[model samples]
Target: MSLSDDGGYGGDGHRGPETGQTRTRLPGGDGDLYGSGRRPRAGMSSRNLVTIVGVIVLLLAAIAFANRDGSGNSESGGDSPKDTGPGAARPTAPTGTKPVTGKNGQIASGFAKTEQGAQSAAANYAVALVSANILKPGERHAIVQQVFAPAKVDDMQSRLDAAYSTAFLKKLGLDAKGDAAPGMTYVSRTVPVGTKLVKLQGDTADLEVWCTGLFGTAGAKSTTPVTSDWFTMRLQLKWAGGDWKVDGFSQQDGPAPVNGDDKTSGADQIAKAVEQYGGFTYAR
Candidate 1:
């Protein structure tokens, strides 16, 4: 199943056991020849046939009555089973809060101080951190400064800079400025599938954001062809500057699904699609 299709209705059907008949000997008079190992009377078979038909009908009715899911039982003025009712569950309900308004370059900022805000911050931060824009020196510094807590900024910047060094960019077919060669498109985008508020305390929150993304370069001549990956980013957030900020973060490979059977697109088609689509500012 795709990430987009979580918690859907299955309408699983339950099958009742097959119906059958059991023969039993009833109290009989001396004329009961069948059980006596004698030839049965001619007219007696007719009465036995009638009895079998009645038993089959009654058994079917009992089976049908036992298998009801009880949805319509209340309408008949009967008490439904306590475990079964029309009550619903909203396990994944929306927070009813809107997306953050403020922006720091392409990254969202000024998130609310609530749990929803922390989750929203984590999700948007995932997008910004995994984005193609982060490869560029200017954008990388700006993102680190605006999205991370004050104490984390310097460390994160140094680490990211080293990770995306000149040699790394060259290997990935990008220039020193993190730009793709002409006729090629470097694609890096993270689409958040969902978010979880793992814990929340007075001034801190721990959250996880599940995401799937496109990464690498897309072009026929490009050595690094863009591919998709799944990963979950865990964010340690703290309330700061009247908003939630990332104190630190870590990522794990995935809860990935098996690859699907969709037809693969050409390099030109992938490049065109990336250009046509825009990124999102996510919320819980």
Candidate 2:
């Protein structure tokens, strides 16, 4: 989404990321079995019909049992069984490899030359880019410099400055400097749910990150109370200066699921939670 004057819903009007669609087939009628001009024999009793159905059911069950261990269950053809699970596989345990051992300013840097490293870099950069610090001119510039390729940093910084201008801050109930008013807590946090490497070449990679973010102000008097959002960011990364850096990126509304029925927290509680929790440096 763009960082324009309309809070965080600045781009397209979609509520969340695009979700997969489900298809369903209704049961066909038995009219085809008995022709329009034909009917079951008058001699046929209800008991006979029941028996016929039982036989058909048994025959189908036997066929299914016979094919239980057939090609449908094999992993070599069609879609792999693992790929047809409820959603993406559960994240594996850490491989004991550190995400990144180096930092550029406050952002993670020095990623390894591997797919995992690319994912890690994308995740961390997603978090940093959506952070409240990105609204401040100085911190925004620093973050752009650290997370982006050196060649693109200046251009990105200029674009971002315009995107997060004073008018945009005012629309979000913040001041000219992007600070929340007194007794209000401004929130802009991103949590990466998962990362998928869409394409990987020798020195470039495209990664999509599913993320949930909290943004807006928190306080009883706040016009824009804190709220959550779901989206996927597609990041085009390049191996530059010996580390994975963002070359460009785009965002789309989500693969968001239905919201739960839990009670909403009060302004004070939300504000306290945001203060008590710290963000993580994510890895794939």
In the range 1-284, model 1's lDDT, one tens digit per residue, is 01110111000010001121111122145322112122222333555444434432332232233222211111212232232322111145676666586887777887887766777898988787667776688888998898878876776677557555776556556789989999888777778888876667788776667777765456655433444666666667788888888765555556667655344456677789999988877876
State the local distance difference test value for candidate 2.
Answer: 0.59
The backbone clash count of each candidate, in order, is: 0, 5
Cα lDDT tens digits, model 2, 109-130, are: 8888787898889899888876
Model 2 stretches with alpha carbons more than 4 Å out: 1-90
Best by TM-score: 2
Backbone clashes, candidate 1: 0
**lDDT scores in order:** 0.56, 0.59
Q: In model 2, which residue pairs have backbone atoms overlapping below 3 Å?
A: 16-253, 16-254, 17-253, 17-254, 18-254
- Write down the TM-score for model 2: 0.70
Residue 40 alpha-carbon offset, candidate 2, angstroms: 55
Worst-scoring 10-residue span by lDDT in model 1: 8-17
